[model samples]
Target chain A: MRSSLLRAAHAPTELGMKIAFVTPRYGEEVMGGAEGAARSLAEHLVADLGHEVEIYTTCAIDHLTWADVLSPGVSQLHGVTVRRFTSAAGRDPKFSDLDARIRVAPSSRSIEDSVAWVAANGPVSESLVEALGDCDADVVAFYPYLFYMSVHGITRVRQPAVLHPAAHDEPSLYLPIFQRVFDSADAICFHTEAERSLVEPVLHTAATDQIVLGLGTGQASGSGRDGAAILGIAGRPYLVSVGRVDEQKGSTMLYEYFVEYKKRHPGPLALALVGPVSRPLPEHPDVVAAGIVNEADKWDIVAGAEVAISPSAMESFSLVVLEAWVARRAVMVNAVCGPTMEHIKASGGGLSFEGYLSFEVTLERLLGDAALREHMGEQGARYVASRYDWPVLIRRYEAFLESVVARGRRSEVKR
Target chain B: MGVDGFDLDQVRREIAAEVLARRTSGSVDAVEERRLQRLFEQYSPHAGGVGALSDALRSVDATIFIDPDVPVASSQPAGAAIKKTVRKANYWYMRWVTTQVTKALSNIAGVLHQVGSELDRINRRLDLVSNDTPAVIQLADADAWWHNRASEAVARAKGRVLVAACGDGSFVATLTALGHDAYGTDPRAEVVPTHGDSLDLRREGVIEHLDAVADAMLAGVVLTGVTEAMLPAQRTWLLRALDRVLAADGIVVLHLLKPEFLSGEARPVALELAGVEPLRPSTWVSVLHDRGFGVNLVDGGPDALIIASRGPRAN
Candidate 1:
């Protein structure tokens, strides 16, 4: 157990410690998952946890350059101090290797190019190193490690650093670089228990101290747990799948199965596929394709659903599943993904399927038995409240930071 | 002639004294005093010699020339007679002044009408410069008309395209079409991304970009109403895309709503917002110029019909 004194000392004072968050992209320009996570976490850290947090990221246009080497330059965003290094898209020698790869396979335009740009630019230039030398910050945190500027900037600063690896896929591919970065950090954080498990194999030392942080979702105050409609039945009752139309997201299987199931159930039931139609699907009046819904609309879909289906084969963690649990909707998951299975086992929120028949049978059973669905949903919501709320997750994060900082300080003293 | 009537001079003096008393006392009665003073001022100018004499006695009245040749007895008895004659003369003078004032006012009104007509002409010319050339101005007028027409058409067809062609991509985005696709082609390709999938522009290397874009396979294409102002070559490409690429049953809609006024010969610059660059109309027309499209005025007016078909046939 870490010392209570250490914990109390780390308890953020009312004055609040200054935290600089570094990312490849921040604000409204790039509306990706990492951007969403950074914004949500930053808000909670500042508003709920009593920390003054500012995010530093690169501009969409400014490719990496030697000129970005200056420390602590301010960004046009919300008065947050941002030091922008040129993007890797430009001609810089350090990124020559990654640029070679990109030239061969140019499909992944933005992310890979940015990483190469930062690597060539020597992370933060000497001038930017001098600038951060002047800043008064207790900690610098980096979110989702694509930005080389962030990795370079924080590592040189000698401040307690927290690296939150938001995604856990391609472990062997991407984890080694992160593992080294994490080793340098005072603490490491992951969003889900499943993510923590993936990293545990690499993290031989200090595995226990590294925390599994819960993602903060928007306030679900207006959501109700009961009386959602069952739209359609494939094998037994209606099951709905909501997600982007990608191969990784298994909506194709659902659509194929739903077509078969429609023949068996002669009654009026709906198997709605609500999400952005990334690819065109054949028109079916029975299947309501509510495309690209906003946040409120997404929650409404979840709340109105009897069973929320997640067939993702490659999700790091299913935010949609978490949302379904919050709405007290029955979550049906494919057991292949580490995060989905772990969440289901831990929360008892929903059923997981090992095969197609298992998914169909479980969905059928849930549909036929309303009592079982209701009880499971209740259990899920309670489990989510106990494990995933901001207060519970933020405390774990604070403790992990304290442990890291204490260990670092003790080591420094011994030396 | 009316000595039996109440003494008007005494009444005037009494009212004035009361007003002074009220004002000096600082009573709320000061409001009443002000009201009474206004009444006195309005009626004083027309008041007979009795009030005039009272004004003179108070040293507030100006003196007028009097004929000394007139006998004292005649004047004294004639005072009543004089008052009657003076009243008659005053009435005639007032009537003459009223007629002259009416004539002057009518003349002023005529001048004002001429000025107003001149201002309207100037305003119309200014509109040609300030309002007409702006793509948004013409777009808004066309869109409103298109919306009403499209709504009726959509109700009948159930599945048809509501094609809107304007330099303003954002406005085109707001139109309703069944399986709707809105195309706003411009030399500026940068603005295309902001309006999402439906908004597409013709670029310098459009053939290559189109091939790359078509590799993704869009569901439908919308050719909004075209204008003759576009360069001849670009119109040919548009026609080609329409005939070759557009599905056989796909509908092509056009808008020709004209504005009541146009801002003549005014160059309007697009305003830049955060994250979005401004694109001018000339920049938009250049797309057509490059594509070998020809625009003809459908009606004998400034309005035009943009005929979209296969590329222009060989001469």
Candidate 2:
């Protein structure tokens, strides 16, 4: 990577500095994408760069419930200090009602209504904020812009605030209260260019510095096998989709399309839904509802498939597509998904489908040609290694954080 | 190997065009699910006809382990104590039973794996059956033809140069003698030279060595012997790794075996073990060209000697 993002980060700079990440949830078991990403980044900061890192989060596991289930206290998770505070303001009963009002036209909502909506969104941990206010870390990263930990807690930190804002194109993003969230941030980190485009417009006054510092992929491992013992689709060709199987994630759409495709194509191509099943899946003979498989099995299923499909269009950055590419599996993505569409086009690793007709055509094309699939998968893998490897990301982040620290120092001098 | 010069964008365009053509042909969604699924099953990466045999073996190997430990406690107070006492009393019996079960299970699992040696011999013979082309046996040459050319090509290489498949480290010594910090890796144990340790000659294949190497660490590479031995997938991985590890100005000197060397020759055991043929030198040149490299085919004779340098796409 001659003109690499990491090239600037690799240049002479600070060696090690204390970094803190404040997220709403924290742990491997906590499957929220943003929280998991935060954990990986924090761990990499420690392991790869030898930086002192800590995580300040509410003891909340369930995103929807916002209940403080995990024991509240300082603990070591994956070699990083994770300080969990009991959720002060849990999800309010009136939160859904208030959220509904703000959901329709968030920009037009009253400041008071927006603030209430945020608080009602809950996971309001006052103790975590109080701790952050006195913390000695160089900078605190408040993850995923929608959360109270980021919106409210970012203001409480003594050090420079870096907001990761795992921001997606959603109604909650336009809330009047978020103008301050972006304004108060020292530096902003975005997941993808598409995400940056969506959120930057909402920033009336942007942060001092910002970067599309995306998430890294797990270096591909394991040989994918026939789904005989794992998914019971032994010797059967399968199309695997990894991630939560839900309506919002577009699994329903994917299922309908596959069922239609199988009818049209007249073949025994099974569809494997590999994730935590939230909604009821159909009892079709071909659909293998593998629930939530382990990471090894997930890779195994994905690698073994004729094609891997990322059905969701709601992604900020589809890490699954990168993962599939790493495993050398060709991918099919939702055409409307800006970030995933961008990835497919840029990498030429996969195809995107607008609907059933497009899906039918793309799936057939991928299934028929082994050489094309292999080429595309290799290209995707190359894209991921060049752009989103942890080493590359951590270096860019190190440089970004260093600048944030420098800016903070400058601001203090001005004061 | 067959699908040379395959372009994804071109393929996508063709697919789109076909889809459009099919749509124009008024093809309706009247296909059968059961039949389509069966056809799909055959196309699965897992079940590629005889390749399914490999999958079955992998499956057997993966599932062979029989974990012996099981929970041996009781919920009731007396029940737990009684169980513990009985467990202690029958410890020898329990150990014997577990041991026997484990042994039995292992023996069953080893039923396939035990024939590994026989399978190797069978596989070597099968390679000849599958591919009847003659192989040209190239013995290790201390004064190899490409040594001087490689030595000169990487003269100004910024960092250490790697001489892969350096049989007896002669080429590596030649480069080191020429003042280039050259190291080598060869898997053959008998080829261990007296100064192998000092020369940084690791006992592993180049691909294995490159897999663990830090990105953009190598200044130059000299590949020999093992290039033809690589499987198609391994070849792709080697290219990717070289792209990642080789510096911008890095030169790669490839001493590829002649493609005319086929399976019929009284070949080395390693050649039979490799179970593959050499890719055409032109194919390598074209691949390197496609990947944005300044390729120079120094000698496309008895054994093709190509020198390639990173081009503008060295990212």
Candidate 3:
């Protein structure tokens, strides 16, 4: 009883270091790659590193409307304290007009035009900006470079700001305003080496301040047989893809590729998709859309699969691919996604294809040769164990944060 | 009027200071927020309501100034004439700017075209120079390891020695300079600069040309660049194929990358060779052993050098 009381009263080293994460959207309902990562990392920072964590986010749940549906106040989510503020102008009807105008001719736009574009692009919350400025935290991390909260809020905060810019090679990234954000970041944490390489040439920041601290994946358990039985596919073999079933996530591409694969080579192999289906799946005997399975079942499905596919070309860091590797499953990824391709190249745990021909060949090789499949799976498991295990990743993250804080303190002393 | 008598500058300065303070406060205080709202309300109504009045004044001005029907003798007609002259001057200035911009763009395009052609010429010259000069092997540093290996292979074997995937043919040139009958083969020979014409270098596949060599005709074969790029099956085929042309006592030198030196991110150039997986030293040994070759490793520290001879083959 005494020990427990002491533990509750005086938490150990790095325990009281408060971190505030500013993302455009937050909560369990919000299902974006960056949001999910931010939430998970924040929770882990608190639970594992013993740090005090909070999130400052807009009251909007849906990214489409950035409306303040949630109450504008502080609330407890899991363990972290979430402060939700109102968006003064949420999703203006003329947002698309401004977006199109900017895209049509970005170079021709004046400073006022760009400013108006940012204002109309929605989720422009004066209150949120004020909250970010006033919030007292050791460090504030603004997620995803695209959102206005990250683009604008990051500069306003007095605390040392770290930008977890989930950047991709898109037209919006070329906007002149982001150049300042990237340049001003006290420390930048990238999800992958490719991401760092991409940002370094553009930002030209010192290497010491930028770190490639990839997210960790949970370990997988349970046999393939048990997982297959749980999914009601006891005997049938299928290729599983887990994520949002949308065109942007490359679900459409995966569906089309599977169709072409079936046309060329008819077999008992099926495609099992487990995610939030943004688009309706076409009726096919071989395709099964298991929408939003439980987390355990999702892991089970991954373990049961013959091969896991990640077809998205615009990924910053594919956590799903790492999960697939953890399940000892060989993965096939689109060659264009820098993060996934980097994973494949580094681990030699999976195969990547540029086109359908390469895909067909790689797929046939993995499916036809059981020994090869086993070898690749073993390679993947080893890679995940060595690099992505949570404990190892958490320690690295803790050390990186400690160093960043120390550096900030040194600069503060000098000031 | 009283409005003109009012000190508008003082009011503007006071309002600007109030807004700046509010913004810097980072939070809305109830009393201050109401004050700020009232200040905005005081001026927000008339901010954009002048459109109709401005349009009417502009029309009246245009009729008096730009209209050709206005009498030039009237006092107002003098202002109209001056306005017309100013409009024409502005139009001419714009036209001059447009013409200059067009000329400048045209000149830039011409220069770019010239630069493109020059680049093309340089590229062609580079291709020729690359073929004529030895290609720099961008891998492990060149040391006495190549010289020692070449000399050892020549001394140990009889008949013509072939070096496969001999990048740049510099090693072949070295052997030739030593008066040993050494020939090099590189599929990308056009890109790799070579020594003088006396060096026996061929622009073809090492395997395809090796098939043409007479049995027991070649004393030694040195395989390098493409060794790590072949699948285990392909490597097995290569060794078996070598047995057909190579003398029973001839030695085959396989230069592979040391797996210890390899990092997860350092992609060996050989990984791009289609239909192949990167190989480790152990895999090379097993592959060589499977094709009836007794293995001998030459430890050049960083390099994975293996010498293979015909022996009891592993099935």
Candidate 4:
């Protein structure tokens, strides 16, 4: 499905072209999908494609607070330069109050009120906006449009702007203000077709200048025993879920399902979750919550796991699913998520279950038949190799950015 | 032993032999050549074929949990294994052919399915707006009720009111008689009163005329029988345009024609108005709200009126 889009579009050129990426937050510690993707793309562009890439971001460590955790300075990661600026307005309770009001009592809010709400919803960096206006680059990309940084900075971007909205079925996207952001962009890049579908209706047209250029993954091929040792769950076979372990991410449903699975089929199988925990985990003996793992350990755990379960219902793109594929693990994803379902269907890499019955069936099948699991994992690995390896994917990324540059040049000529 | 007893070297040898045989027979076509080119392009980045295969196998072993007691192969750096595999797997013809055929078939099927889904989406959107209509006319009663309603509505209105899609200019005449400055705009140029020194009715597109209106100039808009005639997209445009021209407190009264009053020319006109389809009153109201309109639905048996005002977040 994605191949056709790539073939249809004009190919990009790789040279000394400079591209600047703008995001609300930027750091290795930043655990969000868009941030990670931005860092990956930025570094790869510089290292592999021989392009001059710079990142313009706020000096914030956490998205929840948008506070200046990192000192404002220019730093380099994998040859990509990252210049950070402090957000003039950080997090406030009023922004939360206004958001709640907008959700609960939409009628009470005016256009001005909504605009104010967006403003008060911090990461409102005047310096970032100024930097966008002054940036000298062939192309500037603003990511994950929910932020005040994107909403404010994207409009100010002087060069050709490509917006990676990273949008899902969320309330804030429904605001009328985002319409302008969509209109102002030179090109819109989607992480998945489902994200495109979600944005297309709001924009009133299937965007012609859009591409579903998925992110790349660094493949993991190590034993899970290393990860198992780190988590102190060395002996038992376990299925791992890697991400922020919270209820909003359907972690609660996953926990309940795992508990039920344990009861239904008694075995040495344990559910080991490794990530930052936002909510409390059940005190069940079979479940192990390994809090805040480093990248290497995370990959090791995933690599050694029996299966990878991702239960998030709202996901623009599941990096964990791609990572799981890279690790050669069959994944059990929530059937409700668009990106995960689409990925599963395209790769034939795993099974998806919407309810307890399907979940049980999928788990039973994986546990009972080792060959099927192996086959699925192999299928997924090939799919990832053919599509998402940085060596291959960087070309697509370059092509897309080049296409935007070409369009920008043409429009400039017309003017 | 290979990883999990899966011999990567044997698979590579089999592939290489198949490719060499095919090449020796001069059987590789342009399509086959392209497929092989794609395969090399995809997998050539990594160090060695065996190493790549080992990496893939490692992923598979970790993912597919079997009996740990099942003796697994000892670890090799895959450098020697990779060198042996790639050297032998140069003519891996069978795998390449299978991948190419599968990819082509999948692309074709996916394109067709996508087209079918797009058509389904359009059909579904049309269904959301389309309302059931009768075959023949019964507008005499409806026309009378609209005349009285327009008169009452205009009398209560504070400023100039525009009646969009006014069928015969009779409703505009009725509003003018009720001591209100009422102008009627209809799409059909021929529908204008021939004997007009009168400026009450004009043959103009409502959207164009509304666009020409000064911002916040109109005190009210009367769109009684037009919802059935307008496409969902056009209705959205009309509402947005109406929003631009309407005063902060301006009201729009949409007198939705009864499904029963639709017939012959009028019913077919509503159904067949290029891309326009009639929607249920409830659907229209929902659309109005989505467009930031504060709406009130007043039920009047077969005919209904939707009184809408621009909400705080109308823009």
TM-score of each: 0.44, 0.57, 0.55, 0.56
Alpha carbon deviation, residue A86, candidate 4 (Å): 1.3
By lDDT, the best candidate is: 2
Residue-wise C-alpha lDDT for candidate 2, range B207-267, written one tens digit per residue: 5567545456578888886677666666787789789878878888888866675446644
Top-TM-score structure, candidate number: 2
How does chain B score by TM in each prediction? Answer: 0.29, 0.55, 0.50, 0.49
Q: DockQ order of candidates, best first?
A: 2, 4, 3, 1
Q: Which stretches of candidate 2 lie over 4 Å from their true place?
A: A1-15, A93-97, A205-207, A223-228, A409-415, B1-4, B7-315
CA lDDT, candidate 3, residue A82? 93
Better of 2 and 3 by TM-score: 2
lDDT of 3 at B277: 48
Per-residue lDDT tens digits for candidate 1, residues A363-412, read: 56667767666766776787778766777666555555544544342111
Quote the lDDT for A391 in model 4. Answer: 84
Q: Residue B212 in candidate 4 has what lDDT?
A: 46
Q: Residue by residue across A6-118, what tens digits does model 2's lDDT show?
A: 32553322456778899889987765378888998998988888787889998888777789889999999767989999987788988878866765557777778888888
Best by the DockQ measure: 2
lDDT, candidate 3, equals 0.66
What residue runs in model 4 are displaced by over 4 Å at the alpha carbon? A1-15, A104-110, A221-226, A409-415, B1-315
TM-score of 3: 0.55
Error of 3 at A401 (Å): 1.9
DockQ of each: 0.00, 0.04, 0.01, 0.01
